[model samples]
Target: MAKIVNREEMAQGTIILNEIIASRISRKAKPGQFVILQADETGERIPLTMADTNPEKGTITIIYMVIGKSTARFKDLKVGDEYFALIGPLGKPTHVENVGKVVCVGGGTGIAVLHPITRALKAAGNEVTTILGSRSYDLLIMEEQMKAASDNFHICTDDGSQGHHGFVTDVLKDVLEKEEIDLVVAIGPIPMMKFCSLITKEKNVKTLVSLNPIMVDGTGMCGCCRVTVGNDTKFACVDGPEFDAHKVDFDELGKRLASYLDDEKQSLEAYEKANKQ
Candidate 1:
């Protein structure tokens, strides 16, 4: 059982951050890896990227938006509560190198996943710039942390509630035009990633995107997370959650992600109704 040592609510309680005691995972987890956790015996297995890991404290922090039934269950667990199961630092770690000027773009909950990677890039002697976005100011998260991790940090809100007052792509395009960036790492909503990749492709800049396809078993055996990259079927669990942005089939991935929305809605509705009863 992984005990929740601390918990905090963010983005008006729609997102939750939990620091769980997982000594083994904390010790080995690297940037870009994820963990599959189950809230209880009857809960659905859900994969969450580690927002941060503290080896000395033997804890792994996960920040997730409470979108469906499984995440709702995760939100209900308090600091003292424990998870029924938590399975490891899965997927390939980010290929960190001092690749000159690098820009990391993140949107919504993807900002959480981008945090560690940005920090690692900066640590590896790369001048890292981070651009984060949300629909509105209130929806943005981890501002101070992301700022600290990046040598240059910018924010964008679709509603112009704060920061650049435009899409992250706007800031990215401006940066790309002004500087000679060696690489770009983008993680966010599929649409945001798709657009970012599109912009980078035009500039001929190397870009990497982290994918969050439907995953069941964190292991590659499930075949549920298979995605087409440059015409090859790749399982995100084993091959990568990160891929060359230009090679990803974003449209196909977007469709695959929505395949179970109706079912997910029904599940969340039933869980909410049952709880209210």
Candidate 2:
């Protein structure tokens, strides 16, 4: 049983941060690797990327949105509570290189997932530029850490609540035109990542994206994390959670992601109703 030593709510509680004690996992964890955690004895297994870690403190932090039934149950967990199961450091890590100028784009909760990789890029001597976006100011996260890792940092809000008054692509396009980008990495909602890939493709910039399809098993055996990269099937859990965005088929990924939307809503509704008692 891994104990959650700390918990924080961000993005107006739409996102929750849980820092669980796992010394072994922390020491071996790398950016882009994830953990499959069960909320309780009978809870479904859910996978989440490691947002940050501290081996000295024996903790690995993960940030997640309260999107569906499992996460909603996760929201009910408090600090000092223990997880049902914590399996970790899964998926291949991202490749880091000093490719001169690199641009990192992160949206919503993905910002946290991208943070460590961005920091690694900076440390590797690549000039890092980061673009972060969310629906509004309140939804924005990890501003200071990202700014610290980046040589240049840009932000956008869909509602113009803060920073640029439009989509992140608006800023990204401007950057791409004015500068030479050696590499681009994006992680976000399927639509946002797809759009980022589309734009980067037109510019002929090499781009990478972190894919989060429906994953029942963190290992490749379940086949739930299958995704098409260049029209060939790849398992996100094993082959990659990171793949060349230009080669991915976002249309198929998007449809598969929405498969449980209705069930999620019904579960959320039931949870709320039960909690009112």
Instruction: Report lDDT (CA) for all predictions.
Output: 0.94, 0.92
Top candidate on lDDT is: 1
lDDT digits (tens) for residues 1-277 of candidate 1: 6999999999999999999999999999999999999999999999899999999999999999977899988998998999999999999999999989999999989999999999999999999999999999998999999999998989999899999989999999999999999999999999999999999999999999988888889899989999999979999988999999999999999898888888888888898999999
Model 2 C-alpha lDDT per residue in residues 63-104, reported as the tens digit of each score: 999977789999999988998999988999999978999999
In order of appearance, the predictions have TM-scores of: 0.99, 0.98
In angstroms, give how far residue 156 of model 2 lies from its true place. Answer: 0.2
Off by over 4 Å in 2: none
Candidate 2 to truth, TM = 0.98
